[model samples]
Target: MKKNKIPYLLLMIVHLGLFVVTIIKKKDKKPLLLYYSGIGMAYVFEYVVLNIFRGYRYYPKVLKRNRLDSVFGAIVSQALIVPVSAIFITFFQLGWGWKIFFTLLYSGIEQLFIHLKVFKNRWWKTIYTLISLPFYFWLVSKWSIYLDQKPKKWIGYLTLFFTFWVNYLNINFVLVAFLKRIIFKKGWSLRKYYVNFIIAPIYGFIQSIIGVIVTLKNKKLIGLGLLHLVDQLFYRLKLIKMKKWSVYCFLPIHIVLLLVGSIFKQQMLHLMSESECSQRETKKIQSPI
Candidate 1:
Protein backbone atom coordinates (compact mmCIF):
# COMPACT_ATOMS: atom_id res chain seq x y z
CA MET A 1 0.00 0.00 0.00
CA LYS A 2 1.02 3.60 -0.50
CA LYS A 3 2.42 5.51 2.50
CA ASN A 4 -0.69 7.68 2.92
CA LYS A 5 -3.02 4.70 2.79
CA ILE A 6 -1.05 3.00 5.58
CA PRO A 7 -2.08 5.56 8.21
CA TYR A 8 -5.78 5.25 7.41
CA LEU A 9 -5.61 1.47 7.27
CA LEU A 10 -3.81 1.19 10.59
CA LEU A 11 -6.15 3.67 12.20
CA MET A 12 -9.13 1.64 10.98
CA ILE A 13 -7.74 -1.60 12.32
CA VAL A 14 -6.99 -0.14 15.73
CA HIS A 15 -10.37 1.54 16.03
CA LEU A 16 -12.27 -1.52 14.84
CA GLY A 17 -10.44 -3.62 17.41
CA LEU A 18 -11.23 -1.13 20.15
CA PHE A 19 -14.86 -0.95 19.07
CA VAL A 20 -15.20 -4.72 19.21
CA VAL A 21 -13.61 -4.84 22.64
CA THR A 22 -15.95 -2.11 23.86
CA ILE A 23 -18.97 -4.02 22.63
CA ILE A 24 -17.77 -7.22 24.22
CA LYS A 25 -17.12 -5.58 27.56
CA LYS A 26 -20.29 -3.53 27.78
CA LYS A 27 -22.76 -5.94 26.17
CA ASP A 28 -25.34 -3.18 26.37
CA LYS A 29 -27.57 -1.96 23.54
CA LYS A 30 -27.93 1.67 24.53
CA PRO A 31 -24.26 2.60 24.39
CA LEU A 32 -23.92 0.66 21.16
CA LEU A 33 -26.74 2.66 19.57
CA LEU A 34 -25.32 5.87 20.87
CA TYR A 35 -21.91 5.01 19.46
CA TYR A 36 -23.36 4.15 16.06
CA SER A 37 -25.51 7.25 16.11
CA GLY A 38 -22.44 9.31 16.86
CA ILE A 39 -20.75 7.77 13.86
CA GLY A 40 -23.76 8.55 11.66
CA MET A 41 -23.96 12.11 12.85
CA ALA A 42 -20.26 12.60 12.34
CA TYR A 43 -20.47 11.28 8.81
CA VAL A 44 -23.39 13.50 7.98
CA PHE A 45 -21.74 16.53 9.50
CA GLU A 46 -18.50 15.96 7.57
CA TYR A 47 -20.46 15.37 4.38
CA VAL A 48 -21.91 18.82 4.77
CA VAL A 49 -18.76 20.62 5.82
CA LEU A 50 -16.02 18.84 3.95
CA ASN A 51 -17.77 17.34 0.94
CA ILE A 52 -20.65 19.64 0.18
CA PHE A 53 -19.08 22.86 1.36
CA ARG A 54 -15.64 21.96 -0.07
CA GLY A 55 -14.05 22.81 3.24
CA TYR A 56 -11.34 20.17 2.91
CA ARG A 57 -10.10 17.22 0.91
CA TYR A 58 -8.44 13.93 1.75
CA TYR A 59 -5.00 13.29 0.34
CA PRO A 60 -4.23 10.25 -1.84
CA LYS A 61 -7.76 10.92 -3.07
CA VAL A 62 -9.40 7.63 -2.08
CA LEU A 63 -11.20 7.30 -5.42
CA LYS A 64 -9.21 9.92 -7.30
CA ARG A 65 -11.27 13.09 -7.00
CA ASN A 66 -14.64 11.35 -7.24
CA ARG A 67 -17.50 12.11 -4.90
CA LEU A 68 -17.61 8.43 -3.94
CA ASP A 69 -14.13 8.89 -2.55
CA SER A 70 -15.34 11.63 -0.23
CA VAL A 71 -18.30 9.54 0.87
CA PHE A 72 -16.13 6.52 1.51
CA GLY A 73 -13.53 8.59 3.30
CA ALA A 74 -16.16 10.25 5.47
CA ILE A 75 -17.62 6.92 6.55
CA VAL A 76 -14.30 5.23 7.23
CA SER A 77 -12.69 8.14 9.01
CA GLN A 78 -15.77 8.89 11.08
CA ALA A 79 -16.47 5.24 11.84
CA LEU A 80 -12.87 4.72 12.86
CA ILE A 81 -12.69 7.70 15.18
CA VAL A 82 -15.97 9.25 16.29
CA PRO A 83 -17.78 6.08 17.41
CA VAL A 84 -14.80 4.82 19.33
CA SER A 85 -14.32 8.18 21.01
CA ALA A 86 -18.03 8.26 21.81
CA ILE A 87 -17.84 4.81 23.38
CA PHE A 88 -15.01 5.94 25.61
CA ILE A 89 -16.82 9.09 26.65
CA THR A 90 -20.20 7.42 27.22
CA PHE A 91 -19.21 4.13 28.81
CA PHE A 92 -15.88 4.69 30.55
CA GLN A 93 -17.07 7.17 33.20
CA LEU A 94 -14.05 9.33 32.89
CA GLY A 95 -13.64 12.38 35.16
CA TRP A 96 -13.18 15.89 33.90
CA GLY A 97 -9.39 15.66 33.78
CA TRP A 98 -9.48 12.48 31.73
CA LYS A 99 -12.15 13.96 29.46
CA ILE A 100 -9.95 16.96 28.80
CA PHE A 101 -7.01 14.70 28.16
CA PHE A 102 -8.92 12.63 25.62
CA THR A 103 -10.25 15.72 23.91
CA LEU A 104 -6.77 17.13 23.52
CA LEU A 105 -5.43 13.77 22.47
CA TYR A 106 -8.02 13.53 19.69
CA SER A 107 -7.23 17.06 18.58
CA GLY A 108 -3.55 16.25 18.53
CA ILE A 109 -4.22 13.23 16.38
CA GLU A 110 -6.04 15.47 13.93
CA GLN A 111 -3.01 17.70 13.88
CA LEU A 112 -0.86 14.67 13.19
CA PHE A 113 -3.05 13.81 10.23
CA ILE A 114 -2.45 17.27 8.90
CA HIS A 115 1.28 16.78 9.32
CA LEU A 116 1.10 13.49 7.47
CA LYS A 117 -0.89 15.14 4.65
CA VAL A 118 -3.69 12.64 5.05
CA PHE A 119 -6.01 15.58 5.58
CA LYS A 120 -5.72 18.69 3.44
CA ASN A 121 -7.47 21.63 4.98
CA ARG A 122 -9.17 24.02 2.65
CA TRP A 123 -11.28 26.24 4.87
CA TRP A 124 -11.23 24.02 7.98
CA LYS A 125 -9.10 24.72 11.02
CA THR A 126 -7.68 22.68 13.89
CA ILE A 127 -9.29 25.02 16.43
CA TYR A 128 -12.70 24.26 15.03
CA THR A 129 -12.06 20.54 15.45
CA LEU A 130 -10.76 21.14 18.95
CA ILE A 131 -13.97 22.87 19.91
CA SER A 132 -16.44 20.59 18.18
CA LEU A 133 -14.85 17.24 19.05
CA PRO A 134 -15.34 17.66 22.78
CA PHE A 135 -18.85 18.92 22.28
CA TYR A 136 -19.74 15.81 20.25
CA PHE A 137 -18.25 13.54 22.89
CA TRP A 138 -20.27 15.27 25.58
CA LEU A 139 -23.43 15.07 23.52
CA VAL A 140 -23.01 11.37 22.81
CA SER A 141 -22.25 10.63 26.45
CA LYS A 142 -25.53 12.24 27.47
CA TRP A 143 -27.40 10.57 24.64
CA SER A 144 -26.22 7.14 25.75
CA ILE A 145 -27.44 7.70 29.31
CA TYR A 146 -30.85 8.90 28.17
CA LEU A 147 -31.54 6.37 25.43
CA ASP A 148 -34.32 4.73 27.45
CA GLN A 149 -36.11 7.71 28.95
CA LYS A 150 -39.52 9.03 27.96
CA PRO A 151 -39.37 12.49 26.46
CA LYS A 152 -41.85 15.34 26.14
CA LYS A 153 -43.60 16.15 22.85
CA TRP A 154 -41.55 19.29 22.37
CA ILE A 155 -38.43 17.16 22.18
CA GLY A 156 -39.90 15.56 19.08
CA TYR A 157 -40.24 18.97 17.49
CA LEU A 158 -36.60 19.77 18.16
CA THR A 159 -35.55 16.48 16.64
CA LEU A 160 -37.65 17.22 13.59
CA PHE A 161 -35.86 20.53 13.23
CA PHE A 162 -32.39 18.98 13.40
CA THR A 163 -33.24 16.07 11.15
CA PHE A 164 -34.81 18.29 8.55
CA TRP A 165 -31.86 20.66 8.59
CA VAL A 166 -29.39 17.84 8.10
CA ASN A 167 -31.49 16.19 5.42
CA TYR A 168 -32.00 19.44 3.62
CA LEU A 169 -28.29 20.13 3.62
CA ASN A 170 -27.61 16.67 2.19
CA ILE A 171 -30.23 16.86 -0.52
CA ASN A 172 -29.69 20.41 -1.62
CA PHE A 173 -25.93 20.56 -1.23
CA VAL A 174 -24.52 17.11 -1.84
CA LEU A 175 -27.16 15.61 -4.08
CA VAL A 176 -27.50 18.67 -6.25
CA ALA A 177 -23.75 18.93 -6.63
CA PHE A 178 -23.47 15.33 -7.70
CA LEU A 179 -26.32 15.59 -10.17
CA LYS A 180 -25.02 18.81 -11.62
CA ARG A 181 -21.61 17.25 -12.09
CA ILE A 182 -22.83 14.03 -13.63
CA ILE A 183 -25.92 15.02 -15.63
CA PHE A 184 -25.38 18.64 -16.47
CA LYS A 185 -21.64 18.19 -16.84
CA LYS A 186 -21.19 21.29 -14.76
CA GLY A 187 -18.66 22.37 -12.19
CA TRP A 188 -19.10 24.04 -8.83
CA SER A 189 -20.39 27.54 -9.35
CA LEU A 190 -21.44 30.43 -7.12
CA ARG A 191 -25.03 30.05 -8.17
CA LYS A 192 -25.06 26.46 -6.97
CA TYR A 193 -23.63 27.51 -3.62
CA TYR A 194 -26.21 30.25 -3.16
CA VAL A 195 -29.05 27.90 -4.00
CA ASN A 196 -27.78 25.05 -1.86
CA PHE A 197 -26.65 27.05 1.12
CA ILE A 198 -29.18 29.86 1.19
CA ILE A 199 -32.30 29.08 -0.80
CA ALA A 200 -32.67 25.37 -0.12
CA PRO A 201 -31.99 25.69 3.58
CA ILE A 202 -34.59 28.40 4.02
CA TYR A 203 -37.23 26.59 1.96
CA GLY A 204 -36.49 23.21 3.50
CA PHE A 205 -36.58 24.59 7.01
CA ILE A 206 -39.98 26.15 6.41
CA GLN A 207 -41.35 22.98 4.84
CA SER A 208 -40.05 20.78 7.64
CA ILE A 209 -41.31 23.14 10.34
CA ILE A 210 -44.76 23.05 8.81
CA GLY A 211 -44.59 19.30 8.41
CA VAL A 212 -43.68 18.85 12.06
CA ILE A 213 -46.52 21.10 13.20
CA VAL A 214 -49.00 19.26 11.03
CA THR A 215 -47.71 15.88 12.13
CA LEU A 216 -48.00 16.86 15.77
CA LYS A 217 -51.50 18.17 15.26
CA ASN A 218 -52.72 15.32 13.13
CA LYS A 219 -51.22 12.19 11.46
CA LYS A 220 -47.55 11.69 10.59
CA LEU A 221 -48.01 10.12 7.18
CA ILE A 222 -50.44 12.82 6.15
CA GLY A 223 -48.06 15.57 7.15
CA LEU A 224 -45.17 13.91 5.35
CA GLY A 225 -47.33 13.46 2.26
CA LEU A 226 -48.11 17.14 2.34
CA LEU A 227 -44.38 17.85 2.24
CA HIS A 228 -44.24 15.98 -1.06
CA LEU A 229 -47.12 18.04 -2.37
CA VAL A 230 -45.25 21.16 -1.37
CA ASP A 231 -42.23 20.00 -3.34
CA GLN A 232 -44.39 19.44 -6.40
CA LEU A 233 -45.84 22.89 -6.03
CA PHE A 234 -42.35 24.36 -5.91
CA TYR A 235 -41.61 22.67 -9.20
CA ARG A 236 -44.90 23.81 -10.67
CA LEU A 237 -44.19 27.37 -9.67
CA LYS A 238 -40.77 27.08 -11.40
CA LEU A 239 -39.02 27.64 -8.13
CA ILE A 240 -37.21 24.33 -8.69
CA LYS A 241 -37.20 22.18 -11.78
CA MET A 242 -35.96 18.71 -12.56
CA LYS A 243 -36.75 15.93 -14.93
CA LYS A 244 -39.79 13.82 -14.07
CA TRP A 245 -37.60 10.79 -13.44
CA SER A 246 -35.34 12.81 -11.13
CA VAL A 247 -38.34 14.04 -9.19
CA TYR A 248 -39.58 10.47 -8.88
CA CYS A 249 -36.18 9.37 -7.69
CA PHE A 250 -36.13 11.96 -4.91
CA LEU A 251 -39.53 10.94 -3.51
CA PRO A 252 -38.13 7.96 -1.61
CA ILE A 253 -35.19 10.04 -0.45
CA HIS A 254 -37.50 12.65 1.05
CA ILE A 255 -39.58 9.98 2.75
CA VAL A 256 -36.50 8.36 4.23
CA LEU A 257 -35.32 11.74 5.51
CA LEU A 258 -38.69 12.33 7.19
CA LEU A 259 -38.60 8.94 8.86
CA VAL A 260 -35.05 9.53 10.06
CA GLY A 261 -36.07 12.90 11.46
CA SER A 262 -38.96 11.38 13.38
CA ILE A 263 -36.84 8.60 14.82
CA PHE A 264 -34.04 10.96 15.81
CA LYS A 265 -36.55 13.16 17.59
CA GLN A 266 -37.44 10.27 19.87
CA GLN A 267 -33.79 9.63 20.59
CA MET A 268 -33.14 13.30 21.35
CA LEU A 269 -36.10 13.39 23.74
CA HIS A 270 -34.72 10.35 25.52
CA LEU A 271 -31.41 12.13 25.93
CA MET A 272 -33.15 15.20 27.29
CA SER A 273 -35.03 13.06 29.80
CA GLU A 274 -31.81 11.40 30.84
CA SER A 275 -30.24 14.78 31.57
CA GLU A 276 -33.27 15.77 33.65
CA CYS A 277 -33.22 12.49 35.57
CA SER A 278 -29.54 12.88 36.36
CA GLN A 279 -30.17 16.37 37.72
CA ARG A 280 -33.03 15.11 39.90
CA GLU A 281 -30.99 12.23 41.27
CA THR A 282 -28.12 14.59 42.12
CA LYS A 283 -30.46 16.95 43.92
CA LYS A 284 -32.02 14.11 45.92
CA ILE A 285 -28.67 12.70 46.91
CA GLN A 286 -27.49 16.12 48.09
CA SER A 287 -30.58 16.77 50.24
CA PRO A 288 -30.29 16.32 54.03
CA ILE A 289 -32.00 13.28 55.47
Candidate 2:
Protein backbone atom coordinates (compact mmCIF):
# COMPACT_ATOMS: atom_id res chain seq x y z
CA MET A 1 0.00 0.00 0.00
CA LYS A 2 1.17 3.43 -0.87
CA LYS A 3 1.36 5.73 2.13
CA ASN A 4 0.53 9.41 1.86
CA LYS A 5 3.48 11.57 2.69
CA ILE A 6 1.46 14.73 2.27
CA PRO A 7 0.30 14.65 5.84
CA TYR A 8 3.83 14.44 7.15
CA LEU A 9 4.97 17.19 4.85
CA LEU A 10 2.05 19.36 5.81
CA LEU A 11 2.72 18.85 9.46
CA MET A 12 6.36 19.86 9.08
CA ILE A 13 5.45 22.81 6.89
CA VAL A 14 2.99 24.19 9.40
CA HIS A 15 5.41 24.08 12.30
CA LEU A 16 8.18 25.50 10.17
CA GLY A 17 5.81 28.26 9.24
CA LEU A 18 5.16 28.88 12.87
CA PHE A 19 8.90 29.04 13.47
CA VAL A 20 9.27 31.60 10.73
CA VAL A 21 6.38 33.63 12.07
CA THR A 22 7.81 33.52 15.54
CA ILE A 23 11.23 34.54 14.29
CA ILE A 24 9.85 37.51 12.43
CA LYS A 25 7.40 38.48 15.11
CA LYS A 26 9.76 38.06 18.03
CA LYS A 27 13.08 39.25 16.71
CA ASP A 28 14.57 40.60 19.91
CA LYS A 29 14.35 37.37 21.90
CA LYS A 30 16.47 35.10 19.65
CA PRO A 31 13.59 32.90 18.55
CA LEU A 32 15.88 30.50 16.73
CA LEU A 33 17.71 29.57 19.93
CA LEU A 34 14.48 29.04 21.81
CA TYR A 35 13.02 27.00 18.96
CA TYR A 36 15.97 24.63 18.60
CA SER A 37 16.42 24.26 22.34
CA GLY A 38 12.78 23.37 22.68
CA ILE A 39 13.23 20.75 20.01
CA GLY A 40 16.22 19.27 21.84
CA MET A 41 14.40 19.16 25.18
CA ALA A 42 11.30 17.63 23.64
CA TYR A 43 13.48 15.21 21.72
CA VAL A 44 14.69 13.87 25.05
CA PHE A 45 11.13 13.33 26.21
CA GLU A 46 10.17 11.48 23.04
CA TYR A 47 13.34 9.44 23.22
CA VAL A 48 12.25 8.14 26.61
CA VAL A 49 8.65 7.34 25.73
CA LEU A 50 8.86 6.33 22.08
CA ASN A 51 12.35 4.90 21.73
CA ILE A 52 13.05 3.36 25.10
CA PHE A 53 9.67 2.14 26.35
CA ARG A 54 7.93 1.83 22.98
CA GLY A 55 4.86 3.70 24.13
CA TYR A 56 3.64 4.10 20.54
CA ARG A 57 4.39 3.51 16.89
CA TYR A 58 4.26 5.65 13.81
CA TYR A 59 3.93 4.64 10.18
CA PRO A 60 5.21 7.76 8.56
CA LYS A 61 6.52 5.49 5.81
CA VAL A 62 9.45 7.76 5.75
CA LEU A 63 12.10 5.15 6.47
CA LYS A 64 12.73 1.61 5.32
CA ARG A 65 12.69 0.11 8.76
CA ASN A 66 9.39 0.30 10.64
CA ARG A 67 11.08 1.20 13.90
CA LEU A 68 13.11 3.98 12.39
CA ASP A 69 10.07 5.23 10.51
CA SER A 70 8.07 5.42 13.68
CA VAL A 71 10.93 7.26 15.35
CA PHE A 72 10.99 9.71 12.50
CA GLY A 73 7.30 10.35 12.92
CA ALA A 74 7.68 10.84 16.61
CA ILE A 75 10.47 13.33 16.00
CA VAL A 76 8.26 15.25 13.62
CA SER A 77 5.48 15.66 16.12
CA GLN A 78 7.25 15.89 19.42
CA ALA A 79 10.47 17.62 18.45
CA LEU A 80 9.17 19.99 15.85
CA ILE A 81 5.46 20.63 16.23
CA VAL A 82 5.27 20.62 19.98
CA PRO A 83 8.21 22.96 20.50
CA VAL A 84 7.21 25.25 17.66
CA SER A 85 3.75 25.65 19.12
CA ALA A 86 5.12 26.41 22.55
CA ILE A 87 7.44 29.08 21.22
CA PHE A 88 4.64 30.59 19.23
CA ILE A 89 2.44 30.82 22.27
CA THR A 90 5.21 32.26 24.39
CA PHE A 91 6.40 34.85 21.89
CA PHE A 92 2.90 36.04 21.21
CA GLN A 93 2.02 35.93 24.90
CA LEU A 94 -1.14 34.10 24.01
CA GLY A 95 -3.84 33.69 26.61
CA TRP A 96 -5.16 30.60 28.30
CA GLY A 97 -7.66 30.23 25.48
CA TRP A 98 -4.82 29.87 23.00
CA LYS A 99 -3.04 27.44 25.26
CA ILE A 100 -6.13 25.26 25.38
CA PHE A 101 -6.41 25.61 21.63
CA PHE A 102 -2.88 24.22 21.03
CA THR A 103 -3.36 21.43 23.52
CA LEU A 104 -6.51 20.27 21.77
CA LEU A 105 -4.89 20.92 18.45
CA TYR A 106 -2.15 18.36 19.13
CA SER A 107 -4.68 15.84 20.41
CA GLY A 108 -6.74 16.21 17.28
CA ILE A 109 -3.70 15.86 15.05
CA GLU A 110 -2.60 12.71 16.85
CA GLN A 111 -6.03 11.21 16.35
CA LEU A 112 -5.93 12.18 12.70
CA PHE A 113 -2.56 10.55 12.23
CA ILE A 114 -3.80 7.45 13.98
CA HIS A 115 -6.88 7.35 11.77
CA LEU A 116 -4.71 7.66 8.70
CA LYS A 117 -2.67 4.73 10.00
CA VAL A 118 0.44 6.80 9.68
CA PHE A 119 0.66 6.64 13.45
CA LYS A 120 -0.37 4.06 16.00
CA ASN A 121 -0.45 3.66 19.75
CA ARG A 122 0.94 0.79 21.71
CA TRP A 123 0.35 2.09 25.22
CA TRP A 124 -0.07 5.80 24.67
CA LYS A 125 -3.35 7.57 24.09
CA THR A 126 -4.40 10.86 22.56
CA ILE A 127 -5.82 11.87 25.91
CA TYR A 128 -2.35 11.62 27.39
CA THR A 129 -1.13 14.19 24.90
CA LEU A 130 -4.02 16.45 25.85
CA ILE A 131 -3.12 16.20 29.49
CA SER A 132 0.65 16.49 29.09
CA LEU A 133 0.88 19.25 26.51
CA PRO A 134 -0.30 22.00 28.82
CA PHE A 135 2.53 21.26 31.19
CA TYR A 136 5.05 21.03 28.39
CA PHE A 137 3.82 24.32 27.01
CA TRP A 138 4.12 26.00 30.37
CA LEU A 139 7.60 24.63 30.82
CA VAL A 140 8.82 25.84 27.45
CA SER A 141 7.37 29.27 28.12
CA LYS A 142 9.22 29.47 31.40
CA TRP A 143 12.34 28.03 29.86
CA SER A 144 12.43 30.71 27.22
CA ILE A 145 12.41 33.29 29.98
CA TYR A 146 15.19 31.49 31.80
CA LEU A 147 17.33 31.38 28.69
CA ASP A 148 17.30 35.18 28.67
CA GLN A 149 17.74 35.87 32.35
CA LYS A 150 21.18 37.30 33.09
CA PRO A 151 22.54 34.38 31.12
CA LYS A 152 22.26 32.17 34.19
CA LYS A 153 24.51 29.23 34.99
CA TRP A 154 21.92 26.62 34.09
CA ILE A 155 21.39 28.56 30.91
CA GLY A 156 24.98 27.92 29.88
CA TYR A 157 24.73 24.35 31.04
CA LEU A 158 21.54 23.88 29.06
CA THR A 159 22.94 25.53 25.98
CA LEU A 160 25.96 23.27 26.20
CA PHE A 161 23.80 20.22 26.79
CA PHE A 162 21.45 20.77 23.86
CA THR A 163 24.03 22.02 21.42
CA PHE A 164 26.26 19.08 22.18
CA TRP A 165 23.25 16.78 22.27
CA VAL A 166 22.05 17.72 18.82
CA ASN A 167 25.51 17.43 17.37
CA TYR A 168 26.23 14.20 19.22
CA LEU A 169 22.93 12.72 18.14
CA ASN A 170 23.72 13.45 14.51
CA ILE A 171 27.31 12.27 14.66
CA ASN A 172 26.46 9.11 16.54
CA PHE A 173 23.62 8.25 14.19
CA VAL A 174 25.90 8.53 11.25
CA LEU A 175 28.70 6.52 12.81
CA VAL A 176 26.82 3.79 14.66
CA ALA A 177 23.77 3.35 12.47
CA PHE A 178 25.05 4.14 9.02
CA LEU A 179 28.81 3.92 9.07
CA LYS A 180 29.06 0.75 11.21
CA ARG A 181 31.76 2.27 13.35
CA ILE A 182 30.84 2.00 17.03
CA ILE A 183 28.27 -0.06 18.92
CA PHE A 184 27.16 -0.15 22.55
CA LYS A 185 26.36 -3.56 23.95
CA LYS A 186 23.35 -4.39 26.12
CA GLY A 187 20.95 -2.25 24.21
CA TRP A 188 17.42 -2.39 25.57
CA SER A 189 16.40 -3.31 22.04
CA LEU A 190 18.15 -5.42 19.45
CA ARG A 191 18.73 -2.38 17.29
CA LYS A 192 22.02 -0.59 17.68
CA TYR A 193 20.41 2.77 16.97
CA TYR A 194 18.19 2.45 20.00
CA VAL A 195 21.09 1.38 22.15
CA ASN A 196 23.33 4.23 21.14
CA PHE A 197 20.51 6.74 21.26
CA ILE A 198 19.52 5.63 24.73
CA ILE A 199 22.99 5.77 26.15
CA ALA A 200 23.92 9.08 24.51
CA PRO A 201 22.51 11.30 27.22
CA ILE A 202 24.52 9.37 29.77
CA TYR A 203 27.82 10.24 28.16
CA GLY A 204 26.62 13.24 26.19
CA PHE A 205 27.05 16.16 28.54
CA ILE A 206 30.14 14.57 29.95
CA GLN A 207 31.63 14.61 26.50
CA SER A 208 30.42 18.16 26.17
CA ILE A 209 32.22 19.02 29.36
CA ILE A 210 35.30 17.28 28.02
CA GLY A 211 34.96 19.07 24.72
CA VAL A 212 34.72 22.47 26.35
CA ILE A 213 37.55 21.95 28.79
CA VAL A 214 39.88 20.16 26.41
CA THR A 215 39.55 22.86 23.82
CA LEU A 216 39.68 25.66 26.35
CA LYS A 217 42.71 24.13 28.04
CA ASN A 218 44.28 23.07 24.75
CA LYS A 219 44.15 19.40 25.70
CA LYS A 220 42.81 18.05 22.45
CA LEU A 221 45.47 15.41 21.84
CA ILE A 222 45.48 14.12 25.40
CA GLY A 223 41.70 14.25 25.63
CA LEU A 224 41.31 12.29 22.45
CA GLY A 225 43.89 9.82 23.71
CA LEU A 226 42.00 9.27 26.94
CA LEU A 227 38.65 8.81 25.18
CA HIS A 228 40.19 6.36 22.76
CA LEU A 229 41.71 4.47 25.67
CA VAL A 230 38.25 4.33 27.24
CA ASP A 231 36.87 2.91 24.02
CA GLN A 232 39.65 0.35 24.00
CA LEU A 233 38.64 -0.57 27.53
CA PHE A 234 35.02 -0.86 26.49
CA TYR A 235 36.03 -3.07 23.62
CA ARG A 236 38.06 -5.29 25.94
CA LEU A 237 35.16 -5.50 28.39
CA LYS A 238 32.73 -6.36 25.57
CA LEU A 239 30.70 -3.34 26.48
CA ILE A 240 30.98 -2.01 22.92
CA LYS A 241 31.77 -3.32 19.48
CA MET A 242 33.83 -1.59 16.85
CA LYS A 243 33.72 -3.11 13.42
CA LYS A 244 36.27 -2.62 10.65
CA TRP A 245 36.72 0.72 12.41
CA SER A 246 39.18 0.78 15.23
CA VAL A 247 39.45 3.07 18.23
CA TYR A 248 42.18 4.84 16.29
CA CYS A 249 39.72 5.66 13.52
CA PHE A 250 37.49 7.57 15.94
CA LEU A 251 40.14 10.20 16.63
CA PRO A 252 38.81 12.54 13.98
CA ILE A 253 35.25 12.19 15.23
CA HIS A 254 36.28 13.04 18.74
CA ILE A 255 38.20 15.99 17.51
CA VAL A 256 35.19 17.27 15.63
CA LEU A 257 32.83 16.78 18.56
CA LEU A 258 35.28 18.43 20.90
CA LEU A 259 35.52 21.41 18.63
CA VAL A 260 31.76 21.48 18.16
CA GLY A 261 31.06 21.51 21.87
CA SER A 262 33.70 24.11 22.50
CA ILE A 263 32.45 26.31 19.66
CA PHE A 264 28.90 26.09 20.91
CA LYS A 265 30.03 27.21 24.32
CA GLN A 266 31.82 30.13 22.80
CA GLN A 267 28.85 31.14 20.69
CA MET A 268 26.38 30.82 23.53
CA LEU A 269 28.56 32.91 25.82
CA HIS A 270 28.84 35.54 23.15
CA LEU A 271 25.10 35.68 22.77
CA MET A 272 24.63 35.95 26.50
CA SER A 273 27.05 38.84 26.65
CA GLU A 274 25.17 40.59 23.87
CA SER A 275 21.90 40.03 25.68
CA GLU A 276 23.29 41.50 28.89
CA CYS A 277 24.70 44.49 27.12
CA SER A 278 21.40 45.12 25.40
CA GLN A 279 19.54 44.87 28.70
CA ARG A 280 21.90 47.37 30.30
CA GLU A 281 21.47 49.80 27.42
CA THR A 282 17.71 49.51 27.68
CA LYS A 283 17.88 50.15 31.40
CA LYS A 284 20.13 53.17 30.97
CA ILE A 285 17.87 54.66 28.32
CA GLN A 286 14.77 54.16 30.42
CA SER A 287 16.30 55.67 33.58
CA PRO A 288 15.74 59.36 34.16
CA ILE A 289 18.84 61.59 34.49
Among all candidates shown, the one with the greatest lDDT: 2
What TM-score would each prediction reach against the true structure? 0.62, 0.81
lDDT score for candidate 2 against the true structure: 0.74
Provide the lDDT at 275 for model 2: 74
Cand. 1 TM to true fold: 0.62
What's the distance in Å from true for residue 72, model 2?
Answer: 2.1
What number of backbone clashes does candidate 1 have, counting pairs of residues 3 or more apart or in separate chains?
Answer: 0
State the displacement of the C-alpha of residue 28, model 1, in Å, after optimal TM-score superposition.
5.6
Worst 10 residues of 2 by lDDT: 200-209
Model 1 C-alpha lDDT per residue in residues 1-289, reported as the tens digit of each score: 6787777787788888878877787764434445545655675576579645877766645554344454445556676667686786567676667667777886787788789987777888878877887788787766654454444454345445655654564565455545552112123453433333445655666676865676446466776677777777665655564544544565676677667655655555556667678778878999946
Residue 201 CA displacement from its true place in model 2, Å: 3.7
Candidate 1 — which residues are off by over 4 angstroms?
A: 1-6, 9-55, 66-80, 142-156, 160-218, 233-244, 257-289
Worst 10 residues of 1 by lDDT: 181-190
lDDT of 2 by residue, 161-224 (tens): 6765666655665565445677665634577666665665555555656665566566878888
